[model samples]
Target: MTKESMMLPARTYSVSIDRDWRALYEEIWQPEYFTKWASGLAESDLRADGDGWLADGPEGPIRIRFTPHNDYGVMDHFVDADTGSEVHIPLRVVQNGDGAEVMLTLYRQPGMSDEKFAADAKWINGDLKALKALFTPQRGRNG
Candidate 1:
């Protein structure tokens, strides 16, 4: 048996949504939404290769394809270009009475670094915050 040289660290982050979290996620989590929310976005849908999806930001391009789960959730299978490994990012929705909660979890390979973990955390935190701000109605704001 051979030891793995490089491995990605596991990371997870979540936030509450103003609307139905599952529905909003299913509707909004896409390349278009990333371009709208994420900085320095570059994305495309390559149809020649079975509708492969690509999105790039400050953390480099994350090539992935999405699949909807039966339990009102979704999964992003990240294609590791370097090591040919796959990383799974799972998202779920939790009902919170009038609104909902969005949970995002990132599962990385073993031996991921502190720097990478921190970066991923910061990005997800900020992204969720921004998303909530955009969807949530502010006090005294017009309908």
Candidate 2:
């Protein structure tokens, strides 16, 4: 591979939500809702920035541009750092039986240690769990 072209190691993590695929995508495809579960992307505030958004990440403030709403369940977004580093996050919701499956692909950047990658995977899984919890049925004592 050329120095300018690099392919990073990647992994796709998914969660199953007991909701209709199209309905689930329609409800959660907005960038605003992303902050609710995608902790890795937003630690707190995520405000609009024209076509994209300005969010508070762990390192610092980052710019995120999300794909326009589509008929297909594609919520891909690009996170841009101040240092010119950009991370492509491909998120999707697809039909699984009567429920829906949400998927996020995480890529291990150059110089990222295996331990860090593993931790990132764990973090992604946790985020996916949080997303799943949004649709999971809650049992209250009153019920």
Candidate 3:
């Protein structure tokens, strides 16, 4: 069956980062950088193969296909979870004044309990904070 056929209810969460949109996009919009901030792949090694990316997921190895970078700030991806199901992640980065706002949409799939969904949301929030920290200025750094 097609991955889209298994989609579930989605919830969106966003975080603002004080950095240039283009710079942020260039830095983290690729598959190679996903492991840096995404909690799901935190323990996995990600690599770009052909049209998609290969990585070690929580259950096992998986493949992820991401939308190409565009002017509209879409950074969505389809991840083949170990359950043999494909999960769609919708992400975006839009210009917010002199900075950028990153948004991530999480889908609550079938069989997922309320607590699991809440935990997932918290995890995403932490990941977004980590992303913002990447560009944050250090106390000793000269701007």
Candidate 4:
């Protein structure tokens, strides 16, 4: 593929969180917070590696680079698979009335089987739900 090429067969998944977008983004930036809700994205612990992160993916060890912290609530990340292929994962937290909407875009990579893509989509949906649950309030015993 040429440089700056865009992948096709993309899907965008989103979840609604009952919290301020900025605050949610800040909480997500905290160390270990991501792993709590993104277990499907990284199967093993993620360790700091200079400006990027290293994780033991299901296939093998992989490197990830995240977008720098900013005021715009962007948390885009790129993953480099052990097979020498790189995939861009677009993520964002945006305001939705009094709540926040988190969106993640998944691109169907070249040679990716349909079954694998469907599984990834389901995993992404579950991960997003887990993220929303973090900001959801729990019911007390009285309830």
Candidate 5:
């Protein structure tokens, strides 16, 4: 790899959720749930439009196109940041033991600072935690 490529390696993060891969995929991989758990859309409103969805991004209104759910658990998407730039996010859910692991692979774009990358990683971690908590069973009142 070139020195420049080495400096901007793809970052991957995964979280193990105590749920079936299919179940989790069905529950979380939807346009309605983007704002619910996705860090990038935390403050965005995603709504279905003609072919894709319209979303409010950090810059401004953005267009989002998501890959259809498949048996292989590939849930990738593209977000148009309104600057003639489109970012492709690769995500997957792989079966792991009794549960499943949700993995997100993020590519470090050119000119991205180390601090910004760290912050993005932290944000992804928080989103994964929130996803896990959403599926975790609640304790009983008397217990």
Candidate 6:
């Protein structure tokens, strides 16, 4: 098996949004918004006695569980291609002047290759660019 197929790796990405932390966190970190960011990124309804749930991501079904982070003013959770592990993800939102910064840190499965790592980083950067555009004001003629 390839390195990526055997272990989890840790990765971090940050985004600066032109909005308050609380409002930005609430508005952008929802099931609907996730879906809009990428096709099929919606939360699934959980039935009683359910062990796990899925997020319909564009790539495929991404397994997830909703976790709360009170002080950060946002709900967070773990998401992966599998759900039968002890893996849990923690996300945070920080206030940065009138704008907000969001940091996403994920512990990817170990044994992941350098190429895979590079690809993941590139994907995250692209995603953040899209996210910033979504929240930032468009350039208008001022001068």
- How far residue 58's Cα lies from its native spot in candidate 6, in Å, is 5.2
Stronger candidate by lDDT (1 vs 2): 2
Please list the residue runs of candidate 3 whose C-alpha ends up more than 4 Å from where it truly belongs after superposition. Answer: 1-7, 140-143
Q: Which one wins by lDDT: 3 or 4? A: 3
lDDT of 4 by residue, 14-112 (tens): 999989889889989653567888964445788999988888776778888898889998899889976676789999999999889999999998888
The candidate with the higher TM-score, 1 or 3, is 3
Q: After superposition, how far is residue 99 of candidate 6 from its true place, in Å?
A: 1.5
C-alpha TM-scores of all predictions: 0.67, 0.90, 0.85, 0.88, 0.86, 0.69
The residue pairs in collision within model 4 are: none
lDDT of each: 0.60, 0.89, 0.87, 0.85, 0.83, 0.63
lDDT against true structure, model 4:
0.85
Say what the RMSD of model 5 is. 2.6
Clashes of 2: 0
Cα error, candidate 6, residue 54 (Å): 2.2
lDDT of 6 by residue, 6-107 (tens): 655677788888788988887866544554443235234422224445655555556766654355655466666554554465566789898798776666
Task: Show the lowest summed lDDT stretch of 10 residues, model 6.
Answer: 39-48
Write the residue-wise lDDT of candidate 2 on 1-143 in tens digits: 79647777899999999999999999998889988888866466888989889988887888999999999899999999776978898999999999899999999988899999999899999999999988888889998
Scanning candidate 4 in windows of ten residues, the lowest lDDT window is: 34-43
Root-mean-square deviation of Cα positions for candidate 6 versus the true structure, in angstroms? 5.4
Residue 37, candidate 3: Cα error in Å is 1.3
Candidate 2 residue spans exceeding 4 A from truth: 2-5, 140-143
For model 1, state the Cα shift of residue 45 in Å: 8.5
Expressed as tens digits, the lDDT of each residue in 80-141 for candidate 1 is 44346656666656677767777777655467677767777787787668767778778875
User: Any idea how many clashes model 1 has?
Assistant: 0
lDDT of 3: 0.87
Q: Write the per-residue lDDT of candidate 3 for residues 1-143, one digit (tens) a residue.
A: 89987668889999999988878888888777878788778888888779888888776789999999787778999988666778888999999999899999999978999999999999899999988887887786564
